[model samples]
Target: MPSEQVLLKPRLAPMIWLTETSAPVCVEISDGLRRTLFRRMSSLISGSLVGLIIIAILLYRNPIPAFFAWAAVDTILVLFRFAVIGRLMRILRDPSLRRPRDTLVVDAFIAGSVLWCAQIGVGAFLCMSLGDPVLAVFGTMLSTGIVGAMCARNPGSPRMVKLQMVLIIVPYAAGAAMGPEPWLWPIVLIAPLYLWGTISINRELHIDYLKMLMAQQESSHLALHCSLTGLPNRSSFKARLKAAERNASVLFLDLDGFKAVNDQHGHPAGDALLTAVGERIRGCVPDPADVARLGGDEFAILVHADDERTIPAIATRLIAEVARPYALPTGLVVRVGLSIGIATRRDADNDPMLLLPEADQALYEAKRAGKGTYRWFQPANDADLSSQVRELRDMLPKAQTVREHGFEAGLSVTRA
Candidate 1:
């Protein structure tokens, strides 16, 4: 199978087992989630800064020293978060520098520590009865939202999610456990349930995400490729032509006896022949050169070349290769001839539309001259020949009915 086909195949989840050898799909998902983490972290820091200011104001008169200490700790954490965000922005610019798991771990630890410290200092200042429950409830809700967002953003790594959740929940749980009041002990029980629900939701979201990725891959592949031959279709080929730099060459090919093959053997046999021809053309081209099926028996190849001389050499090879016999599934061998036309960016002034029409005209000339040959596009003579051929085709009878006849020593054929 071709590498393109392999790329279209659905990939397994890389997070099932954490390893350094991750797939490209997983890496892409991780990078996207890492960027999302930066946005979430920014929101979190803003909220934290506001909460710290409000808490400092509330405790300004009664616990002046404690306010200063808490404010100092929060300022340091905020600065560190800003630094991490700066590093994350650098990672966004250069994806190779991404270390999302480590960054997330650091974030989780700092956030958890800040929450724990705030609960301890504020709970003591306001008396345990009111402060402990308020802090516990708020911390639980905040942790749930943070952990849920992280999971939704980066569901490819369950281990990362687990580590973050543990760091986020443990400090708050520990603060509640170590509280001076006995009534606050029940708050610790909520942590495990919250963790379970978050994990379950993460697992489901990850599964759905993988399904979506697979569907998208399949759709994109189908849109750009020929379903019968597994080659790039006409639209893909034209897109490639438009993207090519100067001095690029295009070969337009039409099978000479393809209609006869379908008439003699069957449509299935014709399909098999086309598939084999597509593969053979693909084999003849070098890396970066593209082969595409332009509907029916017409095909196109785009190749990069430094000069005009390279075009004929490549076209010659294609002509020889495409004339080879194809083995059909019904234990019969069939032969087909290719008529190829060459066009280059130099000839078409780098216009894809003009380049294709030029190649089409050349192809018409090649067919007019004889089968199993190639021709370079010449706008002067070939354009008139192409127009005449189109007129002849239009004047031909639309339908023809043939009668069965006995085998004869000689056969006669005529154009419709």
Candidate 2:
């Protein structure tokens, strides 16, 4: 029931409970709601089987046509709900249908759950009104158990739980009040008080859970993003690149004259310059080509085929934007030049991993040509990319170590 604890599960929901909106990246159900549904399904099946046993015992003791009729209708609804739960569980696991069917699946789950509670309430009413002392006690115990389970199992929105609680208790209380026995009147008052108590307990648990979830998400955000520039970190860049399209391109950017700013204006001014430079790079590119700050003065961007801009045009725009003078918080106007290396995937069958080395090789060439310029990988042909990649790998060795933790260990570029 824990949502994939992985860092790359698309957009982090602002608030997952009590409210829902269109997902910006992909449709995702919260972990808590999934857990609650799973428990509900399990409890309902077990409770229904036990209830059938009680109904059978009552019929054997003294045959009642009215009791048998009620049981038949109740049993049919219980069986139908089992089917609904089964289908919903399967739907929740389907990745293809997530975007189109997520809202429908969750809504169906809620509707089925509410109806299950209403079924319990209807039975409670019938049993209490039957004028049989044994049956009345049996129904009261069952209703109380359902409410207790609801209290323990529910971690979804409080509003949905509140609606379910009312459905479960009100009908039973009304039936108890209408009973011929004077002793049954006490149950009517007690039922409302019981509901109030359960809701109070639920509220406290929910608040605590929300606080914990928020803290965990914030921690994950900090780990995957650069603190100075608020851009994705090197690890994040590697993750995104691994999943990039076959026709994607990689760009490696290094800041020229960055040390001059740090030497003259101090580290604070250098920090401000980095932040400003990051913003400018981000502004130069549109969707599908995100920018990442890959440690001091080095940044990378993944330009997928879906982006509107070509690799050369995007690189040119990045160089131009980053080279502009930046006014720091220290009131110093400092400038930095950008050197870019471009590597575009030539074929759909090519391995995406090769793009990284090629981009780095091109960046080296660009720096050699002179700072503040961009260069593309000039292979003899597509066949030469493999041999070049092997040479690059040998230059910086490590096989298994490099692949672990999503390619963060792969690169070893020594600045000349």
Candidate 3:
């Protein structure tokens, strides 16, 4: 028989701890804190088991009702601690409850409900067995109130801190007021332990909030920056352009023969060319002069030139930079060229979009002259070639035979 290969799936780390009666531990929190929480919870459960065994042996030797009553109270709290600690860990571990908003509104409510129910139940059990209905009922009610308040103010306000403080005191008050003999000792010890747990949860909430704020800041920063070139994006560019009150010039620079680079050398080479062009443009622009990737194969530069003469100089630098040879990934060396159109603020147009059209027209003239050149828009230049005629001329060869069937020449075709 031929052997069949079976793919084994990687298992997720278990969310619950079986030793502490299935307590939940949040992995996203600090490793040291998580380790401490885990160690303490585990150790407490282990210690509780040993203590119960010792009590069992003592009870066998001398069957005292007071001792049994104390043991019963201790056992109840231990089980309660196991359940609450387990539930708290589970709630924190829950991916949904990691955010404070999620914890306050959802997890806290659930934890409070469970604690309240357990308190009421335990109180009723003690009342029925120990013949002390007053202390049992009062203590349970206090616990229920404290937990309810904790849940209500769980949103990390001053009120939440105050409620948490009250909760810490409740255990002590209940311990002190409870009838003397055996039950008193467990109550006193349990109070401080629960207080420590509350403080731990509080610190965790603050740390989570701080992390969330940092993440939000990082996302905002990335949105303002271009992912490819690490330059300010078009939106940020527009905002900066509007803010500059100084007389400035805008140059719309388009890479000449970029489409040919993509066709001959593949997109990876085209991308490398674009990144190199971006770097060259960045070098061309001085500080306080901004550049942006307007879109694919096109970039814009806003310059605060020392003099109007600097425009031609800057454009010449850009042309020289781009015309240099680029080493492609295929080990093919290629020359990349650029066509830039400069439009000054002094030029009659006040509208930014108007500058674009004039700049675009000048760019058209530069491309027509051949690659690796710059052109400034001139009012006296009367050459306005129709785009439709240029497009039709491109399509004519493919449809030459079809045109022989019925088409008549009505326009003069010129190659650009």
Candidate 4:
């Protein structure tokens, strides 16, 4: 015969033991709360599974009330699982979303809301269905306020959680003492969950901020340093140019035979020659001046000066500096010339990049006139570029005069 004593009493004591022993243990590192929350979720699922097995075992004897309670909790567990799994997948899809502030807000909102709903809904269901009015009210008030407190004390703000818990639980506990029938329990539970959701949304705004900082740092380094020569690049040159005074002059120098060096000695020897040339140029520029490798085989120098005398002297010094022969790795003594273009800050804007093009044009003229020389963008040079149309008009008449002179010379030679 089955004992009525065993059937009448639920295994409430054993269930309590299972819940307590299996409760999550998370070591709170500075970021320990996240791990704790994760472990708590794991514990909840595992403990719920155990509870379900126990429910199945007890179903053979008067399973009505037990089945209803287990099914209600189980359904709530499924909903919580769905919410958590969705969030996990989203985080995996976007790794940036899992960073501290972003992750805390997101997980706290979705997971906190699901848990809050489960706690209250399950509590209310057990209360109404079991007909234990005292137990029902106790479960409802405790679970509802507990969820509120959990939301308040979540990852985003542990202090807020304490305040919220006190405000929420005090009223519920007071009402519980007077049969604990608080009309406001349901509304209080919703407030914290929704508030946390808003906090999570705010966290998303700062995700791009971290990304911007990383990009800015990378760009700053790239702009200031040469990619190949490991020297100050064009951006550094421009900054130095701006700091230069009015009396400072810019000297742009290019290796005259660099292309031939590259063509004859292969690129490896060319690169070595360029590096040696850069060191030699730096040696020539004054201590107060800035030296930079502006681009391939091109260097710019900005020297502070008292008068125009300094610019020509610096240009001469650069020519003498680069005129020395370079000893190749194969021990060949090869000589290369320098074509420098000189410009004063008074004559041009102190923009290294912009001044580079004008200086390059002057350097081209120097090379055309002869190798191993310097040129300046004087008023006459500007006039020469402006006189292209007049030069074209003079050319045909000059050629006709030369042809007539040649014919007259031929007739005189025949008479002789």
Query: Residue pairs in steric clash, candidate 1?
Result: none
Query: Residue 198's C-alpha lDDT in candidate 3?
Result: 61
lDDT of 3 by residue, 178-238 (tens): 5454654465566556655665565455455435644665686588767777777777777
lDDT of 3 at 252: 82
Pairs with steric clashes in candidate 4: 152-161, 153-161, 175-180, 176-180
Q: In model 3, where do residues sit more than 4 Å from their true spots?
A: 1-226, 347-349, 379-416
**Per-model TM against the reference:** 0.69, 0.79, 0.45, 0.40
From the highest TM-score down, the ranking of the candidates is: 2, 1, 3, 4
Candidate 1: tens digits of C-alpha lDDT, residues 210-243: 5666577678889999999999998888888887
- Model 1 backbone overlap count: 0
Q: Encode model 2's per-residue lDDT on 1-416: one tens digit a residue.
A: 32331111213242233332122222323453334445546777887777677667666654778667767866776776677666656655644433443444444555666777787787778778766788788778878777876775665466667777888789888879888877898998999999998888767666665556557766877999999999999888889888778768889999999999889888998899999999999999878687899999999888876543577788888899888888888888888999999888877788877787898899999999988889998776767888898888886655555556345433333321
Prediction 4 global C-alpha lDDT: 0.58
Model 3: residue 335 alpha-carbon error in angstroms: 1.3
- Highest TM-score, which number? 2
Q: Residues 1-416, candidate 4: write the lDDT tens digits.
A: 22222211113443222112122432222122222233345544544454354334434433677556655665566566656555654654565455443334333443444454444444344443444455444444444534433552344233333333444443333333344345434535554565555445323322333344446656776889776566688878888776666676667788887888788888888878878888888787778788888888888877778777877877888899898999978666677889988766674455534555667677878888797888886535767876976898889899999999999999999999
Candidate 4 regions exceeding 4 Å error are: 1-219, 242-244, 329-333, 347-354, 381-386, 392-416
User: Residue 99 of candidate 1: its Cα lDDT?
Assistant: 53
Q: Could you list the CA RMSD of all candidates, in the order they appear? A: 10.3, 9.7, 17.5, 20.3
Q: How many backbone clashes does candidate 3 have?
A: 2
